[model samples]
Target: MTSTDRPLQALLAAHPADLPVPAVREALLQCVQPLTEREQVPLAQALGRVLAEDVVSPVDVPPHDNAAMDGYAFAGASLRPGEALRLRVVPHTVLAGGPAAARLGAGECVRIMTGAVMPEGADTVVPHERVQIEGSTLHLPADTVAPGSHRRCRGEDLRAGHSALPTGLTIGPAALGLLASLGLDRVPVVRRMRVACLSTGNELLEPGAPARPGAIYDSNRHTLRALLTRLGAEVIDLGVVPDEPAAIEAAFRRAAREADAILTSGGVGAGDADHTRQLMQRLGQVAFCHLAMRPGRPFAAGVLPAGDTAAARAPTCLFGLPGNPVAAMVSFLMIVRPALQRLMGATPQVPLPVPAHCTAALKKRPGRTEYLRALVQRQADGRLTATPAEHQGSGVLRSMLEANALIVLAHDQGPVAAGDSVDVLLFDGLL
Candidate 1:
């Protein structure tokens, strides 16, 4: 069978209604086939892009043993107990670029700046604040210095000829700085994933247009496009499609032919006017999952054939996000975002859940998982606490705006009382 003809078993369960959130997520991830396209880009341009291969350090970080503080550099062996030791300071100070003019004597010290190379026989540094300099003499504090103290050793941060970053790591600001330290002007990174995004409904109007009765301005189209772009994807906006099967079919076909993935909001639920799901099944293999999750229960995923003309291209992964703004955003973060990352050649990672205590009682069912919008608070005692946002409704988009995290209540979990610990997924985390 062709790649597009791949069985639904890999992506779909026998029945979606009975599947839990975790099972649905695992099945959805199994459908992904990471893209192979890669290109070399400057380190400055690689931010938020996934690395295509492992990067090795060509030289040691700092390149030499240097002083970690601006202070006096001297030999520790000369320090005597209960004698109030003092060392004669050298005539000249050593800056960060070079070493001292003469080897440090047993009872002599050199005034050294931060990052300056450690001179011969000197294995300790006393900070300028810790010692009193009196006319070229460094008076040490009694019982305050130790051997190998405050010295930054060579290759401490990164050794020469060792793996600096593994493959599939997303290059962030710190990563760019690390690569700059290694003098890597350019590196190979996975190309951006192209996603065709849209909103589908007849009662929806574009933002600037007049909204009459039974019609509301389309918000998911803009939000989904922004979300996709924020994740380093090249978003091809397909705009709002009316609730016509033919119109929906055309949009899906066009998106499949042009983009790496298709993200649609609305028409995945079981409604008479929901033609997106029906058209998707006719055009490709789609799985309609009724996950046991709050905010987002109805979700859909599948593959859309791009046709044979683009033989090098694979079938476009399709994500049918929910119509509600909060539900759509939650679904994308929990499910579609991971799928997109995989398709973009990013390393497989389970998003970390931060532990926090609930500030108030939370009502939940035992059979379904919940993704509630919460304001994660850092207590004065250094403990983390999560307070649910007001009006926790799927359609309430403003609730999502006030949240810094999503309280992830498990499928088997029931009600949570005050002071009970819960795991929350950070909203500020990488998409």
Candidate 2:
């Protein structure tokens, strides 16, 4: 079968009943395909958008050999190793962005400013302080200045016809500056991926509403929306849905119709009501409903129908995360974020683990991977230390705000002692 055909089934067949972290990640990378739609947008609006094609440099950066600093330009061959070198200073000064200076004659140097083109036949510059001026003569002390120093060569930053930015790169501030340097007003970038998010469970209520008995505020949708926005996906907030079959199905159908991906938190956990799960099975293919991971073991992935018509929009990718506040956020960052990035036509990057010393002892089982909420601090010696947050429960949403990183414990790993070196995933970039 083709890779895109029943991709969820194929992925499931390759894994055990309870998916591991690596296998779950591999499945996401292999199953999701980048979107093909693209649009031309001005560089001002292109930040966070993925490039559709390579941006080739039309001309050499700097465009000419120039002085790297405010200094005098002279031929390097005229300098002797052990003796002071003296040369007559040309009467005219060369300013940056002005006309180039005339060719240098033997024993002659020209006053040049920073970024000013090097005069013909000159290949070195000596800062003003490095030399002594004696009436129209420039004198350099012995061994103080080296030949060919402080000169920027043509095409040094970027050669003409070379790629300044490659396809699938998410344009950032630096990339925008580079494109502006090439005088490009517009760039071709992949369209933003639309993601619809919703929270389930009848006991959930929106913020600002009066408190009710046995009801808690819905933080999952808000958290998911913020995370999706940071990832550059256009978020469609579907709000909160109850455990009723019709309401859940209606939300799913609308999400599938309006978004490229659908995210629902609740109804997939082992103890939750089965309304959402039943509808998911009836309307789409379910990949894996559970995983072997702490704070986020219950997870689901698949695709759902966009509309009833045969020629309707393509099936929308589905990410059914756990209902618990902390678990939902962790699942989205660990699994769903990568898939969404791939769908946006951008290359997903693995979060590199930063090794840090744990300040507190931790207990763990051997068969499941655990992510502990931690506040990571850099000591005066540049060493990082991770201290676990006070409460580590999945439903403790406040702990997420209290921590800036997660200490990753491997599946085969056991308990961790104080001062043990452990890998941590910092939230600076990921969040």
Candidate 3:
């Protein structure tokens, strides 16, 4: 539902906030405050980090005009079309990365190498293969090359006193390499956000341990850890917590004390066993939202400061996901991922959706959003086709494993028919 509707608008005007999926997402992103703290790190350690400020180039790339290839350097003005010209080859070879100590006079050429400084009075280069070299003499074809060819001008790559890298960009391998080209040994970037992850449920058990008759291994914690690491957050894994309120409270306290953000899988439902929402009210301020979305409708996020006083340490952001396997993962991707990216001082990143046609009919309901796991395939005619899996259960993890993409259905969308174009969000290559 839109935020301006009568019921939602009145509730927003009266009490604490309860929002739709889109409104909740906007609120969560706004909670990601700007980071002013900066630190210098070596180039090797700066990968996946956000720049704190703009980096300016200290010197021009290829400080002087240099030769682009190993050839004879001479003025093209001396060449005669369709005729062979003779010139004296300088005794000294101008090797790459070396100073050019020779000057070219009329009817004279200097043997030049790639990346070497261009000699004075030389504006062209003829490849050695095109020239016949003789003892203390060289024969260059008249029309073999053009003027100003094979010349690498200074600052062609990066002009001196210019912005090399802008702020708020995440440093990747290519970015680090560019900084190295500028002779930068270290770079300034915002510090990484510390995240605390936890999975809550009495029926959950960690892997590699014996599972009771009713207990199942907790995979949500592992999923959150990997995702947090991929987002460049320093994860403080809190493991699994039981259904008790005290234990949940303890976990939240510890997480708030140490981490900048807290992510929990499960226990946002309005059941007796789920005490996450209750404890959040007592210790922190959180908004529990039942969004109009399938598989991941239940969501919660807010701030939990360290102490009871108003001015405690910086508050820890909390993201409470649903309990089901596929639901938890979907909720994390749709909501928590973007929020964490903003929290880590990165720019707002929106995932691009590709259009695809449906190969088979699928049942859909209006007034609710749906995320169907599907395998996106390109047809022979270059049209993308999305075929939904046989089962679309929230608890089924096999569906998630088999599908490489998600078909996004809007809240007002109805049943989808064959050949209908749909928006698909890819799961691979983006992360």
Candidate 4:
């Protein structure tokens, strides 16, 4: 049978999702993920938020046609080559938003300014530079001009009832301005997804705390929080939980009660003290485990149904990530972020890969896809060279910060020599 027809267990034994980034991505996409939608929010608070419904304009832009230039408003057919016409300029000056009662008769003109309403029976505006205005008198050049010259038509920017923005579109500054122009003080946007984040393992200490022997400061919390915020999520930081089963279970239950999704790092691996996997099995249905990828092999995902009690009426999605800093971050970016977007009523998430050449030899093991930390820089020859960072270990957070791109080495691909082209996953450009 082809790979498509193969059983998941058989495929896992032969080629694990943990080893291939594409396979893991495909599995996550098939999990029936969907974002929730809710009520309207003030336009001021809608920036970076996705729209749940299309926005329609209630009125036309500009509302009426006006003059495009500061010139004489007159009939174009009354002019002849080299013949100057001296006409009486209306005593009333037509400033923008002023009265629009001025009218031009035969052999007559009105001195108009830019953005002033085009007078009745006037079809063209000769610029002030071409007209000689002396007090209440106006002089127009003899050349016959085209009709409708310099006249701005109403609704040129937008028509009434036009779709200004489509659903699923992320609102930006320009979109906010357009809504304001349409007199919209409030807009309907997708509700922000509430996410709860917690870091696991007794070996992890909070930043600024004294580091005990064999323990490191917790960086995953800050990294995940920043990432979730950038995705327009409402994040509830549960801090760090110990590796004990009780503590892990308590955190999961609390998150399941309070948030739409729960994310935790560490303790999903096969180690003796790894309680995240066991806790997940006890708390909810374990949908998938042990994808075939390097650095993030211990990734686990499941759904925690709301309990029968009144307090636990809301179900929450759970993601148990690897303990290693880099691995946790990579897993969160590839899996958790997309899931959260879907939960927030946004479109399917996709990461963009940039092409770059390897600057040195890179080694990889077969059957596991690798995301090697690399510092991408432009050379004098205008080519991008991805130089692998010094430390590639899963626990190395410094390497990820020092590097900008993750060089994706496909599964079963052995060694890559210098100057070989590869796809690099950029962290910042994914937005």
On lDDT, the candidate that comes out on top is 2
Number of the top TM-score candidate: 2
Local distance difference test, each candidate: 0.83, 0.87, 0.81, 0.77
Better of 1 and 2 by lDDT: 2
Once fitted onto the true fold, the runs of candidate 2 whose alpha carbons sit more than 4 angstroms away are 1-11, 14-16, 308-312
- Clashing residue pairs in candidate 4 (N, C-alpha, C atoms within 3 angstroms): 17-292, 18-291, 18-292, 18-293, 19-292, 19-293, 19-369, 35-342, 35-343, 266-323
Q: Global CA lDDT of candidate 3, please?
A: 0.81
Residue 235 in candidate 4, Cα distance off native in Å? 1.3
Please give, for residues 194-275, the per-residue lDDT of candidate 1 as tens digits. Answer: 9999888889999889869999998888888888888889999889888888888888888989999999887788763677
Which pairs of residues collide in candidate 3? none
Cα lDDT for residue 202, candidate 3: 86
Q: Estimate each model's TM-score.
A: 0.92, 0.95, 0.86, 0.78
Clashes of each: 0, 0, 0, 10
By TM-score, the better pick of 1 and 2 is 2
Model 2 clash pairs?
A: none
Against the true structure, candidate 3 reaches a TM-score of 0.86
